[model samples]
Target: MSAWFAGLLLAAVSVLVGCRIADTDAVTPVPQLLAFLPWLLVPTGTGLLLALLGRWWVGVVWGVVVLAGLAWFIEPYGKDSEPSGPAVASFRVLTSNTQFGRATGALLAAVRQQRPDVVFVQECDNRRCDIALRRELAVAYPYRQSVDGAGSQGSVILSRFPLEPAPGVPAAMGMPGAVADVHGHAVRLQLAHPMPPVPGGLGPWRRELERLRDFAAAGRGTPTIIAGDFNASQDHAAFRRILDTGLYDAARLAGHDRAPSWPSRTTPVFGVQIDHVLLTGDFSVTRARFLTLTGSDHRALVTDVTLHRR
Candidate 1:
């Protein structure tokens, strides 16, 4: 019976490790399941116990799984590097999914407290919410871009710097890119709020992520920042492809990527870090922190970033 149980545990670990490598979430529910990848420690420890109870093979197999999981978890930290050029500008960014704008009050309060130079909000749907947020945040963020629709089709970018539509990058699915003039330098800022990977929505979700990859690659040498509720974590191959285009996650750069931001307040223990602030081309993250916003399931992500003149 112990052997049978040990074998089952080994198989489970193997499947998880395989998923981590292959990222079988393109059109499946793997992303949702992979969000809980850190929980693999439970089975790993159990397998080690079985080995101590005479099943040495269980320990050997589980040991390999532990190594693979550790490597994946630490991969983000290695991707971050220091800026190689002279400093140009420094600022803070905050991003959040406002649960369809129902968390407007909390989001505003967070903006006031964190005082981010730029803010990206997803699910800020309806016109009334947009007007209210604009009015509330006018004093700090005079420059703004808002794309409104019903349900999850809305997104907004508020910046202290002057903003203009990024002509080089086209809007893809709900993602919008803009150019912000920071101290006379152009910084490409994008708001990312792709379709949720729900049943029958996987295709759109994957395509949106691919577009983001292309968008990042299109602006080769410019300093760029993409922030919002991506609904996909680093564990997903789709999201990683976006990073492949020279972008590094701000949280990862600060070695704080493991701080979960989703499903906040409720089911707080089972949350995953789905929201992100990704950057490329002469940028260094000084710090990253997550803030709890009332009425929203996701915690706001705030990062301090410095851009370098290369």
Candidate 2:
């Protein structure tokens, strides 16, 4: 019995260590094993709880171990802070995963109401091209780049400012990466939609993450903004890789830690902020919040950011 208990404790420790390692690299596959660890230890944790009232030191130790293991599995919370600069002077950006050509009117209305200086739309479909929506947005956003086609499960960035598209920045399969220079601000935007682990495309998803890292690194000196449906949660390896690049997550930086933007129309259970906007360089986020659901699986992420003049 003692030997069996020791084996269980060892297993818990191993799972914690594996999760930590996975957090360090975006290329690493999501640790599905770690996700199941808590379920496996529930019985042990309950036993420890019962034993604690009876003054069992063994139970106390097991409780500590279980708590520690659970803590390791959770993502560390960011310290909350107020926006640094003038919120009114900041440039507003809205990013939404459109679920590929659904609810054109609602999508257009959301964009028009927000009037963000820059808008990033994901899951763009070729068949249901909303020409009227495009025309309406064109009035405000003169600069746009969209690859709406059958093969191109890509994204589009419509900007109020002059947008000069960088070469090789077109959307691609899996994680569609794009970069655009917004009014001389070299904002590197990546519309990543990484494949989920269960679909046997984890390798391709990791490769896409590697590609995004290389792209972001290539534009090291400029102000970079990467946003989209990363598919990977905050706890996943792919999301951590972008964070490791020394860029600030706009939402976290603005003090909205519990904000989850995915599955927009659904409840919080389906929402976990798979959509994100990350910034690097001399800029401060004024405010960040998830917008109302626009009939899609993911909520729109709107951020007000001020770029400090050099």
**Candidate 1 residue lDDT tens string, 1-310:** 6656666776766676777766566345566666656766677667656665765774666666665774666455337667788998899999998887788889988888889999998888776557678788888889988776765667788999999986422343356668999999999998988877887778877878888888889888988898988888887778888988898999988877778898897444667789999999589889999888888889999999998988
Q: Which ten residues in a row have the lowest lDDT in candidate 1?
A: 167-176
In model 2, the Cα lDDT at residue 308 comes to 56
What's the lDDT for candidate 1?
Answer: 0.79
lDDT of each: 0.79, 0.62
lDDT at 174 for candidate 2? 30
For model 1, the stretches where C-alpha displacement exceeds 4 angstroms are 23-27, 48-78, 167-173, 266-269
- TM for candidate 1 is 0.90
- Best by lDDT, which number? 1
TM-scores of the candidates are 0.90, 0.78
Runs of candidate 2 exceeding 4 Å displacement: 1-17, 21-60, 72-89, 129-132, 168-184
Clashes (backbone N, CA, C under 3 Å), per candidate, total 0, 1
